[model samples]
Target: MDPSTLLITFLFFLAALLYASVGHGGASAYLAVMALLGVTPAEMRPTALILNILVAGVGTFKYIRAGRFSWSVFWPFALTSVPMAYLGGRIHLPVRYFELLLGVALLFAALRLLIKPGGEREGLHPFALGWALGIGAVLGFVSGLIGIGGGIFLSPILIFLGWAETRQVSGIAAAFIVVNSASGLFGLLQSHPPLPAAIPFWMVAVLAGGWIGAELGSRYLTAPWIRRALGVVLVVAALRVLVV
Candidate 1:
């Protein structure tokens, strides 16, 4: 492989490690980096989504084994998201529009982190199901369009709604990402044009980096810090997408 390809792969793996360490799937960073490297948006989205599935799945399993999984809090959102994700995958939007929207969403998410109100709750609220489903569907659709795993939005919503603590939220977000990415990939498969082959070296690098990072994140990192860091990264990524 060429030096440029090698460099890109290395950057990708590094980004994966950073994101996984924070309990993110790294789609926003991946998209920004790919854009900088001149990858076509068409290819970048699906590729990032595939990577998200791999990383998030590993993290989700870790969270689950640690007894942090919350099915009741997760299922309603997942139910709404799966179909929307498929729909988003089937439709192709203008690249500039998609990027702009993603940028705006990230910015909003960043602002949310900055101004997050304090909250504490014992369990899921009965009325939050509708909100969860609606937000999940919107996030899922965007995830499919952008090839993310939807955890970026999911985690924030959980925090805002007081459904779970930060660590538990991370685990739930990982599981949610895995499920939505699987559904989105299934949808993408039905497209007229199929996805490109997984670059074996890149895949291996991402998987290795993600596993190591996620393990450390689950064991050592605090949820609030993870969320804050993820928000900051998203903001930077959004700016890169919009301006560069």
Candidate 2:
């Protein structure tokens, strides 16, 4: 492999470890790194989505086996999100516009984390289903458009909506990401675009890194702290995208 491709593969591995350690799927970071590497946005989105599926699927299965997932809470959001994510993948938009929007979305998520009000811990509020579906649709669309897995936005929203406790959110997020990614990938497949043959090495690296990192995060990290740290990282990533 060329030095440039090897470097990108190494970066993907590093990103996977960081995300696994933090309970993130690493879409924003992947997008940022791809942009910095001068990867076309068209290639970046689908490639990242594929990586998100591989990583998040492993994490989700682990969480499920450990009884960390709550199906009661996951399905409603998936109902709306899966379809919308597919729709988003089908539509074509300007790369610059999409990246700008992604940056704005990340910034908004970070800001929400900073100022969110603390309140009684309700397990999936009465109106939360509606909110979940609505939010899921919007997030799913954006995720598909950008080739993201939707975990960055979905995890925080789950925390904000009081659907699940902070400790349980990561596993839930993993499952959510897996589902949306599958939908998005299906949408992309239907479009008949040529797949990048060189992506397998990078995918393997990300998968390994994400699995190991998520395992550690789930075992040792505190939920609230993980959420906060993820927000900080998102802000930095957003800045990187916006500036470049």
Candidate 3:
């Protein structure tokens, strides 16, 4: 294989490891890698979603087994995101400005993560159905528009808002990523985005990375470092859009 493909695969593996540890599927990081390597837009969204499914699904299983997942916390935010993500996936936005906006948003999120305290804390925000619906719809739109699974955004939100602890956030984020990705992929079906021949290879690569990472994060990795790594990922993604 060529350098670019090989590099993408390697990074995907690493991304899965880091992301799954925190209950993500690494879609943003994958999108960044694809953009830096010049992957076409048509391919980027669907491919990211597919990969998101693999990593997030693994994370979901692992986190659930670890007793970190809470259905009560998960259902509220997820109630509306699926349809919104599908709708967002169907509409095309102008690439340059859209990506620029997304990059800025990611940069902001990274900053927030960098400053937060390390250990998981008791939830501070009151969980309201309205808040859940609002956040879900907004993130769902972003997921469809950008091909992210929305876990990156959600994990930080849950933690910063004190809605969930670190490992619990991972569990929730993993489940969110899985559903939104599936729904977004369904929305992108009109284009029949060409699955790269190497997708299966990437899947297996992510599987291994996701399993190992989720295991470590759920069982071993400290909360602070996971947030730190997530900050690095957001920075890379932002740079891919802003400078790459």
Compare the candidates by lDDT and give the number of the best one: 3
Per-residue C-alpha lDDT of model 2 across residues 10-73, encoded as one tens digit per residue = 8888887776555567776777777788777667778888888888887787777666678877
Q: List the residue pairs that clash in candidate 3.
A: 123-162
Which stretches of model 1 miss by more than 4 angstroms? 114-127, 192-198
Q: State the lDDT of candidate 1 residue by residue for 1-244, as single tens digits.
A: 7775677788878877777766677777777777787677667767777888888887888777776678888898899998998888777777677778767877897888766666445255444777888988998897776677888777766766778777777788888888888888777767644343445676787888788878877887766677777678668767966886
Candidate 3 is scored at a TM of 0.93
Error of 1 at 215 (Å): 0.9
Quote model 2's TM-score: 0.88
Alpha-carbon local distance difference test for all models: 0.76, 0.76, 0.85
Q: Pick the candidate with the highest TM-score.
A: 3
- Candidates in order, TM-scores: namely 0.88, 0.88, 0.93
Tens-digit lDDT track for model 3 on 129-152?
788889999999888878889987
Clashing pairs in 2: 20-213, 20-214, 21-213
